[model samples]
Target: MLEPEHGLIRQVEHAHTKCWVCVLSCLLLASVYVGSLYVWRSSLPRDHPSVIKRRCASVLLVSALSPAAVKAWIHWADIRVDVSVWELMGVRLEGFVPALILPLLLTMVFYLGPLVHSAMDDPDGFTTELQSVLDVQSWRLCVRDVVWLRNQVVAPVTEELVFRGGMLPMLVPCAGPTAAIFVAPLFFGVAHLHHIIEQQRLQRDGMSVILLVAGMQFLYTTVFGAFTAFIFMRTGHIVGPVLCHSFCNSQGLPDIGFALQHRERTALLFSYLMGALLFLVLLFPLTDPFFYGAIPVCSLAPAPEPVC
Candidate 1:
């Protein structure tokens, strides 16, 4: 294959349109969703069950469903072909392995390791808090089913599209990779505060529990959010974050249940440290495109300068 004799930026300019749009959408949504979360926070009771349901629904609709629908529409209508003139062509990977896979792998290491440890520390305790408030109903099965479906399937699909697909691109131009990564997680944590508060409403002493439980949940989501953003940035694929998120969320639940059951101090500390580590890692410069790699080419590469 013929190769260009310019910086990496020159190469990316000629890449595919659909690919760029997908990446761009990820970045844009991440920022918008984060902004929306902040706006809605004060209006809702942090510990109300209805508030949690509403917040979850809002996020799901905006981040995943809407964007996916738009994508489908564009593809089906053949708008992609019409928009081809605006695309960056020739962005094929240089080798068998995607350059992004390594960075993504390392990021997973930091996110998953800590998340697992944290969940193990705070096991089934969250459940007791929920059960004590209600008459021990058979809804346990339903709750479990919903939680699994929500986290494993629904959440991953919706959240990945928003943070990684939509909002992330908006940040890349303004903040570059470093800020983009942190911003996504920060917003993710803020967004989940509603759910934590919802959990609190089920308890008698709602105010007292809200802070602790919300903080724990926030720590869990923020780390994963950052990691997912990293996946989007590196691989430029929406699926990366969804897979990582589902895997991470699935692994942590049982451990969290166990921690709640035993109420072990070691478990708590272990989980906390893991969150802290991830929090700290969020600040590090871990292979950002602008910082460490060759310049990227865009589809918008101007006509080649006439040879002087």
Candidate 2:
């Protein structure tokens, strides 16, 4: 019944609003999610099939329990907004079509170089790749790959659900939409710090290098987390962020250096630059709530602001 607030106080109107409470809740949620992965003791490497599957189960359990944060908010915050926890987390059916397409398209725009390079580098050509994609058998192969499934499917769904979907609602109540977009992702980035332990255990690199790589990964995930959070708030739909997250996972990071050194460097560079430009230009318009329906995110905020 009691939601404690501690740490830096963030100003907000109303009899009581606790951004710090939401933040601490997020930290606890993220810690549990990350800590769950290590509960299954195994000498096997992180990538081992058994280890990966067990960790997957652990994370999923934590992810499933994450909605408790929202439930706690509903009870203690005495929230004024008219919204169900499901709608606040963007689980509703409305605006789904745009959610399913627009976010993914906008994300693809960010990786145009890699996409083109991947197609051109295909020895058998784009048609073969297209056919493979269309082939149900290839999909079966994909399903069989545990690591691929973890990355492209389970990770995206659970992560967006818990990190962006669950956390953002709590955050927006006190942080405001813009601040929520930036703040919620910090927990996401911190959750990834567990990777340092895995890499260090494997001794794949020196401690400094491992730390550096972990730092870079943290940066990447945090930035990507912010993007997903933005779209989630904008479209007021979790499906859009989930789709975008999965697509980004499949694409991985685009290698600007590789594009610069590619044999067809000119075209690749152009595509890369243009893709960045297009993504920036289309970011707001594509995610405009006008296309997605009413700003369901408003349901999460305590009071309507320009953000809603």
Candidate 3:
């Protein structure tokens, strides 16, 4: 019964409402994330057991809170919350494996040259380091690294829940899938800038180094956010991005120092880089939803009627 102009106005208002919800949800989550870190750092010794427990609790609290808040907002706004956890968190083989592997493979390729050079140049040292990593005692220390815990497991779950699971669906109503994919990641990228503040507090690094490091982090995290958003949209599940994030954190970034020093290593690095590029070129086709038979990602709003 509504006229065309009235319908357009309604759509605009709906989009604006959804956008506001997404922004406010992200802001609330970011505040909790950074605030918890500051509080823990201030209250306890850096390595204290209480700090670890508190960090885990804070992450869990915020992760749980964000989704609940979103659901409540949706219901209160008279919007349907039809997205399921399975749709948000399911792990199908086709979608999950590639999602997990591609980033890891790219990371390995990035480090391939340096790793090969290290093995050849200092075989004993390399073997010793490998052995140490594999050693039970070393694993115990790794388990104790709160930062590792946060990055590998906690952050993946909570961030995916907040950003991909919560925010992206809300965004789909307002922005469509393409815009949602790109826009939600901006918040993700900004959320990570808090790392710079944390680093400055802990390290007495010169301003130049701090700024450079922070800049690179912001760039990479933003790019990775976009990538994760894409994966979430394609696979229609939070699990895809969560696994990818965890694997990425485990692999960390490649150290290319050896490639700079040796010609052979340089060639190897170039080859790996080329391979990574090829993989990226193929990423979309390989991850197509039809190929995976993934559940269709439900939108937050009903689609408009088609015109004759």
What lDDT is obtained when candidate 2 is compared to the true structure? Answer: 0.83
TM-score per prediction, in order, is 0.47, 0.91, 0.76
Q: Which runs in model 3 stand beyond 4 Å of their true positions?
A: 1-4, 41-50, 89-147, 296-298, 301-308
- The per-model lDDT (C-alpha) reads 0.51, 0.83, 0.67
Question: What are the runs in model 1 whose C-alpha is more than 4 Å off?
Answer: 1-60, 64-145, 204-206, 253-308
lDDT score, candidate 1: 0.51
Ranking by TM-score: 2, 3, 1
Tens digit of per-residue lDDT, candidate 2, span 65-130: 777777886666666567677788888888888889999999989888788888768857666767
lDDT of 3: 0.67
How high is the lDDT of residue 78 in model 1?
A: 32
Model 2, residue 9: C-alpha shift (Å)? 14
Compose the digit string of candidate 3's lDDT tens values, residues 47-95.
5667766877887887777756666656645566555434533334545
Score residue 153 of candidate 3 by CA lDDT.
Answer: 82
Compare the candidates by lDDT and give the number of the best one. Answer: 2
- Model 3 earns a TM-score of 0.76
